[model samples]
Structure formats: C-alpha cells, structure tokens
Target: MLLVTGITGHTGKYFLKELINNKYQGVIRCVVRETSDTSLLDNSGLNIEKVVGNLNDKSFVEQIMPGVEAIMHIYNIHHSPVIVETAIKNKVKRAILVHTTGIYSNFKYASQEYKNVEQKVFELTKQKECPTKVTILRPTMIYGDICDSNMSKFIKMVDKLRVIPVINKGESLLQPVNARDLGKAFFNVLLSPTETSGKVYDLSGEKPIKMIEVFRIISKEFNRQTTFVSVPLSLGELLAKSIKIITLGRINYVEKVQRMGEDRSYSHINARNDFGYNPMSLEEGIRIEVKEYLEAKDIR
Candidate 1:
C-alpha cells in the first residue's frame, strides 16, 4: 500500500500516472482537500481511494498510515515534520519528501522553511530508535504544462503584452526541471529505497539558461516579436516592495524580483548517479507546455 499527499498537484498527478502506466497494482490512497479537483485522477481509471482532509490534522494523518509501505509527500513542506513523525509511529517503512532546490538558491524565508523541514526528515533517519527510512528529493524550478506557475505566466504575459520586462539583463541562470521528469525521479527513488535512503538529491533540467533566454523562449512560443525591456534590479525590487505593501503582504513579489537576479542553477549529478534522473531541456519542455496551453485554451 502507498500513500500520496497532494495527489492533485502538478507533480502528484504525474507521479500517479507513472505508477499506473508501470502497471503498479498496489493499493494507493490520496490525501486531499475537500475542494481539490479530482478530475485528473478520476479520468485515469486508476484504483485510488481519496481521503478528504487537511494535512495539519495530526489524528487524521495517523488514521491513514496503517498498512502503508511508503509515502510520497509532494505538498507543503511545513507539515513534513508532523507527517514523518506520524508515519514513524505507524511503522511506515519508506518515505519520500518532494522538496525544492530553492533551499540552495539565495537564502530567504522560503528557503529557510525548506531547510527546516529537510532537517526534520534527516533527524528521523538518525533516530536509532525508528525503523522508517526517508529520502528527500529537491527539484529546481518545476515547469511543464499550463498548470505550472513558472514559464506559463511568462507565456501568458508575452501573449498579451507588447513589451516583456527583464531584470538587469536577466543574466541569472535557471535550470527548471519538467514536472513529469520530477515525477519519474520520485518513482525511481521509490524503486530503490535502500540505495536512496537517508540521502538528498537535486533534480534539475538538463541545461541551464539565462533569464532573458527564458523570456525569449516564451515570446518565440507565442510567435510574438516582443521587445525585451531591461529594468534596473533596484527599481524592480522597489516596485515589488510597493506592490507587496499595496496588497497588504498578500503578494510577495519582492522575493520573486530578488530571485530574478540570483542564479537558481543546480547540479543534478547526484540525482542522475543515484536514480538516472535525466530531465528534458528547457526549450523542449517549453514547447510541450506551449502546445498544452494552446490546446487547453483552444487557441491552436
């Protein structure tokens, strides 16, 4: 039996599809919110049981741990410690937490939260008392499909705007792993639990490109000869701060603006060496995403 959290999320859906496509016949259970759309899972014809609840409910989390061999936690990192702890109490043998490579990027609140959750997972492996084995998979900017927030936003904006904004030449490097590739990585790690146990690997795209190149790729995908406007990083940061204030901290564009000027590139050597995690290039990923976007909107 296997338990998957955030089963309706981007990577979660792909992970489920990978499991079914591989003829996995094990019992699968998903923990999701009451409002999450389950059409993705419903259309797949996979035998999966859905438990409607929030992850923060400790008792509810414990109730679903019995007879579960492994857990693929692909949701909020903040609840990882509680989930792992509960998994331990129920004697779940294997666990995989889908974290982010942003922890290795420019240090910020989000990175700190990821780091804290990772530490909690690691501490479990060292607890000579518990028999549960944990693996952490950190993926760089996950992009692919229209559901992705990374390049999809750029593609939408470039389709509507005359001029696309680029921060400080947008030279900062980015290596975005396709969500499907990340899903495969998760499956691979589950296949070799012992070999990947107590280890953390960075899952990234095959190639890294400049930020400006990302904007150009989106423009090219939309067939738009849009002008790229290079704005000063300082000015962009100021605007982001101003927006944050206007939105009453509802939107933190400051972090997004700051990250634009910092390299988010990461090495996938460990992931490749460990689980043969070879991801598609940014261009190919973007092409597939554009096709999906166009199809979804009935534009192409």
Candidate 2:
C-alpha cells in the first residue's frame, strides 16, 4: 500500500491523477485534515482509504502506518521530522518528501527553518539502522493553475490592473516548475525507487526567465498591453512596511520585495537524467494558467 498526504492540494491532485492514469496497482491511503475537501478522491474510482487527522500527531501517523509500505509526503516540510521518525519506526520501505527550493534563498529568516528541518531529516535517514529510504524533491516556485498562489496572483493582477509594479526593474531570474510536471516527477520517482532513494532532485522549469517577462507573458495571453512601473528596492521595502503598519500587520511584503531582487534559478539536469523529469517552458505554462484563471472567473 502507498500512503499519500496532501493528495487534495494543487500538486497532490495531479499526483493522484498520474497514479490513476498509470494504473498503479496498489492500495492507496491518503492523510487529510478534518476540513479538507475529499470530493476528488471520492470520485476518483480508486481503492483509496481516507484517514482524517493531523500529521503532526505522532499517534495519528503511527496508527495509519501499519499497512503503508511507501509514503508520498506532499505537504508541510516542517512535519517531515515526525513523518521520517514514524516511517523509520514503522519500517516503511520508501518515502518521497516534497520539499521546496526556498531552502537556497539568501534570506536567512525564510530559509533557516527549512534548513533546520532538512538537517533533521538528513540526520534521521543517515542512521545505519534506518529502514526507510528517503528521496527529497525540491521544486522551484510552483505554478500551473488557479489553485496556485504564485503565478495565479500575478495573472489576476496583470489582468485586473494595467500598471504593474516591478522590483529591481524585474530583472531577477526565476524558474518556476509547473504543478503537473512536479506531479509527474513524483510518480516517476516513486516508480524508480532504486535511482531516487537517498537522492535529492531539483525540479526546476525548462529555463529561467526574467521577472518582467513573466508579467509580460500574462499580458500577452490576455491580448492586453500592460505598463510596468519600476519600483526601487528601497522604495518598495518602505511601501511594504508602511502597508503592514497601516493594516495593523495584516499585510506584509517587506521580505517579498527584498527577495525579489535575488535571482532564483536551479538546474534539473540530474532529475532529467535520473527519472526522465521534464518541465514545460514558462510561455506555454503561463498560457495554461491564464486559461484556467479565465475559466475559473468566467471572464472572456
């Protein structure tokens, strides 16, 4: 049996689709929160067991680990230590952890926690007696649909507003992997356990593109001419701080503006060679996102 978490989330949904499409002949168990909508799983027509509980609860995770031979942990990297410890105790064979490339961020405040959790995971799996073989797949910014938080926001903003604000003249490079591509990567890695276990793969996009070009792509998809206003780093930070204060800490973009100046690009050559991982180009991916956004909002 294969245990999957976050199966209802944006990427997880796609992963589940891949499993169904590929005819994975295994009993699948999914861990979900009490409030998570399981309509998709209910209609998926697969023999799946839905266990509702918090992954942070060790006892809850332990109870579900009895028959689960493999695990696809797709949510909350912070909860990985618990999952790893439990998987080890349960003697699970293989575990695929979905982590983020944000661990490489230059911003210490954001990257420190990821580093700490990853360090713990590394230490846990290094023990000689550890039974579970772990594979960590770190994806760059994930974007493909309206459910995503990254490009969807940009798509909505670009569609609604004619003038877009850009930090550092929007020259910083970003390589965002599509959610479906990441989902396929998970499925491929799961099948090729021999090559993926005890390995780390960076699932990046086909190539890097400038941040300004990202906005421009959405504009072109909508067939609209958009104006980009260059906002200096210092000024952007100041405005973000002011917004946070005025909103009583409800709105905060101070760190986002700061990080916008840093280039975030990673190579996935190793992933391609090992698991046949291939990601779509940004132009094509953004067009899909725009179509989804338009359909969701019923906009022409």
Candidate 3:
C-alpha cells in the first residue's frame, strides 16, 4: 500500500490520476484534511482509502505509517521531518518527498527553510541506524493547471494588463515542468524505490526559455497584441518593496524582484537517467494550460 499526502493539490491530483491511468495495483491511502475536496479521488475510480486528519499530528501519522510500503509526501515541508521519522519507526521501506527547485535559488526565506528540511531528511536517512530509504525530488516552476502559480498567474496577468512588464529585459530563463509530468516522475521513482533511494533529483522541462519568450508564448496563446515594457530590475525592486509595505507582507517583494534577474533553469539529466523523467515542451504545456484556462473562464 502507498501512503500519499496532499492528494487533493494540483500535483497530488495529477499524481493520483497517473496512478489510476497506469493501473497501479497498490492500495493508496490518502491523508488529507477533513474539509479537503475529495472529488478528484472520488472520480478517479481507483483503490483509495481516504484518511481525513492533520499530518502534523504525530499520533495520527504514526498510526497510519505501519504496513505502508512507501510514502509520497507532496506538501507541508515543515511536517516532513516528523513524517519521515514516523515512517522510519513504522518500518516503511521508502519515502519520497516532492520539494521545489526554488530551494537552490537565492530566495532567502524559502531557500533556507527548504535547505533545512533537505538537510534534516538526508541526515536522518543516511544513518545506518535508520532503515527507511528516502528520496527527494525538486521540481522547477510547475505549470499545467489553472491552480498552478507560475503560468496560470502569467496567463491572468497577460489577460488583464494592457502593457505587460518584463524586468531586466526578461533575460533570466525558466524551465517549467508540467504538473502531469511531475506526477509521472513521482510514480517512476516509486516503482524504482531502491534505485532512487538516498538521491536528490532536479526535475525540469526539456528546454530553458527566456522570460521574454515566455511572455510572448502566453501572449500568443491569449491571441492579444500585448506591449512589452522592459523595466529595470532596481526600479522593479523598489516598486515591489513599496507594494510589499502597502500589502502588509502579503507578498514576497524582494524574492519576486530578485528572481526576475536570476536564471531558474536546471538540468534534469539525473532524473531522466534514473527514472525516465521526460517532460513536455514549454509551448505545448502552456498551450494546454491556456486551453484549460479558456474553458474554465468561458472565454474563446
């Protein structure tokens, strides 16, 4: 049986769909909050046992950890250390943590936090005293659904803004992995538990594209002649900081502006070699996202 957390999220839903499409024989135990929408799982028509509870609760996690061959934890990095520890205690064979490639970036808060989590998990799993093998997958900017943060936000921005802004000539590159492909990568890692164990893989798209080209792609998808304004990074950071103050820290102004000038592209060679992580092209992926967005918004 496989224990999956965050089965209702964008990636989780896709992962469950992949598991169903591939006809995975294992019984899946999904741990989600009581109020989480299980419609995706309900419609999946796969072998799934739903557990409604908080993963932060040690007792609840410990109770469900036994007899589970592998665990794919897709959310809540803060709770991962405890979850991995419990899995080790219960003799679970393998654990896969779906992290983000942002950890490798210059973002201060998120990078430090993810680094801590990675360090903790790796240190624990490396101990000969611990039996449960752990594998970590870091996926770059995921974008395939209306619920995604990267392309979806770009789609909405391009849909609204008369003149879209591109910071630092938008020269920084991004390689976005489709959420569906990320799900497949998780499944592949699960199948080759021994091969992927104790390893960290960076899952990204096939090619890195400039941010300017990204905006062009989205604009093309929207079928709108949008004007591009190349804003200086320093000025953008100033505006972002001001907005941050006005928004009462609701947004990450520094990270957002700084990341605009830094390349976010990463190599997926290791993941491809280990687990056959083949992601769709950015153009095709964004086209799918645009189609879905148009359908959802009832717009042609």
TM-score of each: 0.94, 0.97, 0.96
Lowest lDDT sum, 10 consecutive residues, model 2, at 291-300
Q: Which stretches of candidate 1 lie above 4 Å from their native place?
A: 43-45
lDDT of 2 by residue, 1-300 (tens): 999999999999999899888877879999988889899888887888999999878899889998789999998898899998899998999999999999999863769999999999999999998999999999999998988999999998998999999998899999999999998999999999988899998999999999999999899999999999998988998998999999999998888888898999999999999999989889999999898888878764
Clashes per model (N, Cα, C within 3 A): 0, 0, 0
Full-model lDDT, candidate 1: 0.85
Better of 1 and 2 by lDDT: 2
- Measured on C-alpha atoms, candidate 3 has an lDDT of 0.88
Better candidate by TM-score, 1 or 2: 2
Pairs clashing within candidate 1: none
Model 1 CA lDDT for position 43:
72
- lDDT at 139 for candidate 2? 96
- What tens-digit string does per-residue lDDT give for candidate 3 at 190-258? 999767998989999889999999999999998889888999989998998988899998975787788
lDDT (10s digit) by residue, model 1, range 50-145: 889888888899888898899999998788898899889888898898888888756366888777878877787678788788888888888888
Error of 3 at 250 (Å): 3.6
Which portions of model 3 miss their true places by more than 4 Å?
none
